[model samples]
Target: MSLFVTYVLVLGRSLESSRGLLELLTPALELEVDDSPLSLSLHAAAIQLWCLVNSRSFSSSDKILTEAYSRLRTAIQDPLQRGCESTVLAALLLQRYERFSAVWNQHEQCHVHRNGALALLRQQKLDGINSKHRGYLISQLFHSEVNICISKKISFQASEITWLRDQDLSILPSNPSTALDIIGASIASHQHKFTLLSAEEFITASKPDLSQWYQDLQDTEDQLNNWPSTVPRHWLPQTLQSGKHFDQSIITYAGYSDIYPNIQIASIWNLWRTYCLLLLQIKLALLGLFPNLDEPTGTTQDPRIPAFKVKSVQLAQVLVDSICQSVSFHLGNYIEPTSLSELMIPTILCTSYHDMDPSHISYTLYQKSSLFMSRDDHRRHVIVQGPWHMMGTLSHVLSILADSESHIPVHALREGQMNWVRTQFLRVLRLLRIDLEDLSATNQDHCQANPGDLHALNTVNSEIIAKRLMAALAG
Candidate 1:
């Protein structure tokens, strides 16, 4: 009945299943358990959060979580505790709790913990932390913070942390070079200080300048372009085809049975492409060569804009295809339940960016993702971090597609084809417990039909509907 007892039970179950995670925790658990009550509480809370997230037992895990937070708060009150090992561990535990719980209201608390962790890192300095447990916690906190900042579309203010930038790539077993590259790109994307351009300048390119902003962009672009050469041949996506139809096959990677490396490589590949696509868009926009999504009054006056749009579409297609391949490959492997959850958020983003057309592979891939999300337990895997929800991202993407349908003629499908896609997403939203009213009520005219009309009951089944929708779109 007590929080400790419940946590112990959950930890026991976790140890039986996840040897990798348990291995990561063993040093921390061993070093902390006998040190103090606070250390033990922090370790227990971190384990509980991880188990609850993978188990999808949000409701039952609240008691243990509450106790964890209460103890963390008490531990942080002493001024001398600022750079202590236990204090940093507690902050890291709270950060994990915020990530796993995925509650909107708790996001600010997540930020609080993030800031707390950064401050601790700044105070102690990375070299000062003698314990391997403390070092691992620091690395994780930095990784998680960078990811959080990227998802939120904000600047990572702690980009000045020397240790993170100075980390040796050769020392790391998995090679986090790609992750670091993305973090740099993310930080660069938000550098609006030197230029008069707003933070949203990347999207609109309202003002053009050649300052530190341009330099940062160029540096990131060079890094991305040069990345493939640095990758070991074994780590690279193997060529599946060699000749005329090479692009499609080149996008596919050789499958791996090892889930961790497979995920790491696939995620790095996808994120790199996504950022490259984004950078291209920004560059095209700056050069006044980006096509407007709205109805074209005349045949594209500038040939460059249309060409760039074609390139953009190609990049988006590659992103979607890569995600599908990653998912399919991972699903084929024997994986733990939560091994795929971390990939879901970025997968949703990449899929949404894809401009759907009958000929494009994205149409089929999107359908597969929809069906995946419709599974009974799949919705729990939808990660919630600031301004990003799986359903919300999906809805936003659908809205864009629906809007674009009115401007660019979609001759691939019969009448009401787009409506069916909308209905499919409506079903997904309902299943995920997201309110359709929130999306549709704001702009009733934004969608072709009311959410009320798009019910799951009218469809034969999700898979059949998906198949029919794909068929209809193809037609």
Candidate 2:
């Protein structure tokens, strides 16, 4: 896939819906196979597989997918023959396929493709492609790596990209996707470097000066606190209560959820809130990690820990409520599986940040976070772009949620995540009178959404879900 291919998705065609995407590709297929047709085929196959998985019926032994993969693999063997940009696109498509298809199988080549893409991008950057076009792929590769770092809980520099290091933060406008990515970068960096602030590491021979670690953490925290000031006031999210007019209901699970003109803006705001909560979680974990330390005297109880706890609870309450409030909007009439996937990452993480209290006492961050939503948020709908495994809204919401649950439950989620999933997520189900020990996320192996007949399935399910969801909210 050349830069033109990516432009087809981002700038050229209007992908207001999946049908628009299909229309975009119809013409793409007729073009001369000059710029890596295998790459386009790989992407097309991934989309077809996504449609199949969503359709709920399929039988080809994945031969089409397999052939596309083979062609992409052979093409990449001498990447320069077709160009590394095209290979990176194919690799990214493969990365995406692995994510949503995790329920069927975990492809080991997932990282092989990602690393290959990264290596090529790094080589290009080091050699200086000098073309602004390559910058888009670099930005995407940068975003992919950022997501991997945060999702995998690795340090910020864990996958250092030199371009990212040298990129000036101020040039990116304050509140859009770029700024949000920068925010994630900062938090991921802090999460990785947070080790210095740990009391357990204070005495370790390899540890840096303990005070400097605290200073850096404080600086990051301050930066985060001040980030919102940079955003234009009109672009910030507006709070809306349920009894108020909305696409779904008059009230929210926690009494209110925030609303935005569109999903991207919503995600941008939520990302900030979620990242802040995550930073607090990191601090809280450390405080609890060293609770019994009498030897550390003044060292163990940082002055900020108490404040962090209070702020965490307040943020959790507001965040969860607002997310639940907005869940229905995100679930509304229709959405693309890919859009739903992107929107729900922050939604799921917001709940996870507020997670559970092992002592089993304080409050549930996922509270009434929608017994309806918890079920859908994890559905593994396949999209070969990023890690969005979850159910789709209407059927769209249900589809998106189903995919989220599918990963590994099919890829976006990993093991031990269910440690808390078993408790909090199940609690939501129990309230709905459903018997479940954990999120269906733990049931990827049992999922059977094979795609086909989406029109029929969604037509039936959307009406059913819309009615029941409204009743549930009203009750």
Give TM per candidate.
Answer: 0.53, 0.57
The regions of model 1 sitting more than 4 angstroms off are 1-23, 34-59, 73-86, 103-109, 133-138, 156-174, 177-208, 211-216, 228-265, 289-309, 329-475
lDDT of 2 by residue, 1-475 (tens): 3222332243212222111122234343443363353445555554544344244332442665666667776776663634544455566555555543432221222455556666766666534433223544455566666665654446657575645577653422222455556667777776665444445545463323444554565676787787777754434455544443332322124444454433434445555665665665555554444442322434545555565456555654554444444443333322223332443453222221112342422223223222112322322111221111111112122222232211112112223222222222222222122222222433322222421112222122232332233222210
Report model 2's TM-score to 2 decimal places. 0.57
Residue-wise C-alpha lDDT for candidate 1, range 1-475, written one tens digit per residue: 2332232222222211121122244344455544343454454554554553355445555665566667666666766655466666666556645643443221223356657767766666655544444545555555555544444434666444445656653322233443454444354344323122334654454432333445566667777777767654434442122222222212122321111122234445545554554454444443342333222445345554566556655555554344334432223211122323543433322111111243544334434431223221222222221112222323322322333212222232234443443444444434333223334343334333443344323332233222222221210
Q: How far is candidate 2 from the true structure (C-alpha RMSD, Å)?
A: 13.6
Q: Which residue pairs of candidate 1 clash?
A: 412-475
Which is the leading candidate under lDDT? Answer: 2
lDDT computed for candidate 2: 0.41
